[model samples]
Target: MFIVFEGPDGSGTSTQAKILAKNLEKKGLKVFTTAEPSKNILGKVLREALQKKYELSPKAFQLLFFADREQHVQNEVLPALARGEIVICERYNWSSIAFGVSEKVERKFLENLSSSFVEPDHTFFMNISAEKSLERVVLRGEKLEHFETSEKLKIVQEVMLNLAEQSAFTKRSTILNATDSIETIAQNIEMILTPMLFLQNIK
Candidate 1:
C-alpha cells in the first residue's frame, strides 16, 4: 500500500513517516520510506529554488515538482510496490496543490498537473495552526524555506484542509492534530495501521 504524510513545514510529517517506517520494519514488513523532492538531480534543483537560490514563477516551480514526482514514482515508488513493500512517502500530490494555491497559482492548473500521478492508498494530513507551526520551526533552528512563513503556512493549511474534503481524498484521508505529543500521534497511526498490515502479511 502507498501511504503518504502531508502537512505544513515543521508539522512533523517527516518525523512520523520515519517513525512509522521503522516500526513497520521491526515487525518484519517490507517497508520503503521516501520524501519529495526526492534524491534526484531535479530534486536538487528544486530544493535550491525552494531555498531562494533562484526564483521561478509559481507555475514553473510546480512543474518541477511534478517532474520530480514522475521520476520518483517510476524509478522508486513503482518498483517498491511491485516488490510488495509498503511505501510511505512524506509529501505528495497534495503538497503541490496547497503550496501552489497559497502562492496564488490557479488550483485547476495544479490539479491538472497532478492528474497523471499515482494517488496514495491513504494520506495522513498533520493539521496544525500557523502559530504552532511557526513556533516549531523556530525551535528547530533551521532557516525557513520558501513557504515556511506564518501567513503562507496558514493559507497552505487552509488549502490542505479543503483538499481533505474533496472527492479524490475524502475516503482515504485522515487528519491528525499535530499539536499533540509525538508519541501519542505515532501510537494512533500504528493502531490504525496495525490491523491492515496484519491482514496484508497473512495474505
Candidate 2:
C-alpha cells in the first residue's frame, strides 16, 4: 500500500513517517520510506533553491518538482510497490498543489497537473494551526525558507485541509493532530491503520 504523510512544515509528518515505517518493520513486513523533492539530482536542485531562498518563478520551481516526481515514480516508488512492499511517502501530490497555489499559481492548473501522478491510498494530514507550526519550525532551528513564514504557511495549511475535505486522500481522510506528544500522535496513526491492516497488500 502507498501511504502518505503530508502537512505544512513543522507539522512533524517527517517524524511520524519514520515512526510508522519503523513500527511496520517491527511487524516483519517489507517497508520502504521516502520523501518528495528526493535527494536525487532534480530534487537536489529544488532543495538547494528552497533552502537558499533563491528567487525563482513559481512555474520554474513547479517544473523542477515535476521532473523530480516523474523520475521518483519511475525509479523508486513503482519498483518498490511492484515488489509488494509497503511504501511510506512523506509528501503527497496535493503538496504541490498547495505550495503552488499559495505561491500565486492557479489552483486549477496545479490540481490538474498533479492529477496525472499516482495518489496515495491513505494520507494523514498532520493538523496544526499556523502559529503552532511556525513555533515548531523555529524550535527545530533550521534556516527558514521564504515560504516558511506563518502567513504563507497558513495559506498552505488551509489548502491542505480543503483538499482533504474533498477526498483528495483517504475517504475517511485522517487528520492527525501534530501538536500532541510524538508518541501520542504515532498512536493515533496506529489506530487509524488498525482497521486497514488486513487491507494492506504488502509483501
Candidate 3:
C-alpha cells in the first residue's frame, strides 16, 4: 500500500511518516519511506531554487514539481510498490493541489497533470492552525522557505481541509489532529491501520 502524509510546515506530518514507517517495519512489513523533493538531482535543483528564493512563477514551479514527481514515482514509488513494500511518502499529488492553488495555478491543471501517478492507499492530512504551526516553525529557527509563511499556510490548510471533505478522498483520507502529542498521534494512526494490516496479512 502507498500511504502519504501531507501538511503545512511544522505540522509534524514528516515525523509521523517516519514513525509510521518504523511501526510497519516492527510488524515485519517491508516499508519504504520517502519525501519530495527527492534527493535526486532534479529534486535537489528544485529544493535549492526554492531555498534561494528564486522568483519562479506559479506555472514554472508547477512544471518543476511535476517533473520531480514523475521521476520520483517512476524510479522510487513504482519500484517499491512492485516489491510489495508499504511505501510511505511525506508528500504527493495532494501537495500539488494545495501548493499549486496557493500559487494561483488552476487546480484542474494540477489534477490532470498528476492523474498518471498511482493513487495512494491512504492520505493523512495533519490538520493544524496556521498560528500554532507558524509558532512551531519560528521556534525551530530554520531558514524560511517561500511557502512557509502563515498567510500561505493558512490558504494551504484550507485547500487541504476542503479536499479532505471531498468524495475523491472520502474513505481513503484521514485528517489527523496535529495538536496532539507525537505518541498519541502515532498510536492513533497505528490503531486505524492495524486492522488493514491484518487483512493484508490474511490475504
Predicted structure with the largest lDDT when compared to the true one: 1
What tens-digit string does per-residue lDDT give for candidate 1 at 1-203? 99999998889999999999999888777899999999999999999999999889988999999999999999999999999999999999999999999889999999998888888878888999889898999898988889888888999999988887673344678888898999999999988777766666623
Give the Å shift of residue 22 in candidate 1.
Answer: 1.0
What C-alpha root-mean-square deviation, in Å, does candidate 2 show against the real structure? 1.7
Q: Model 2, clash count?
A: 0
lDDT of 3 by residue, 112-199 (tens): 9988888888888899988888899989988878788888888888988887777234588888899999999999998878877677
The alpha-carbon lDDT assigned to residue 123 of candidate 3 equals 85
Q: Model 3: clashing residue pairs?
A: none
The lowest-lDDT stretch of 10 consecutive residues in candidate 2 is: 194-203
lDDT of each: 0.89, 0.85, 0.86
- Model 2: how far residue 186 lies from native, Å: 1.0
Per-residue lDDT tens digits of candidate 2, residues 147-183?
Answer: 7888889988999989887874347477777888999
Task: Compute the lDDT for candidate 2.
Answer: 0.85
What's the TM for model 3?
0.95
Q: In angstroms, give how far residue 141 of model 1 lies from its true place.
A: 1.4
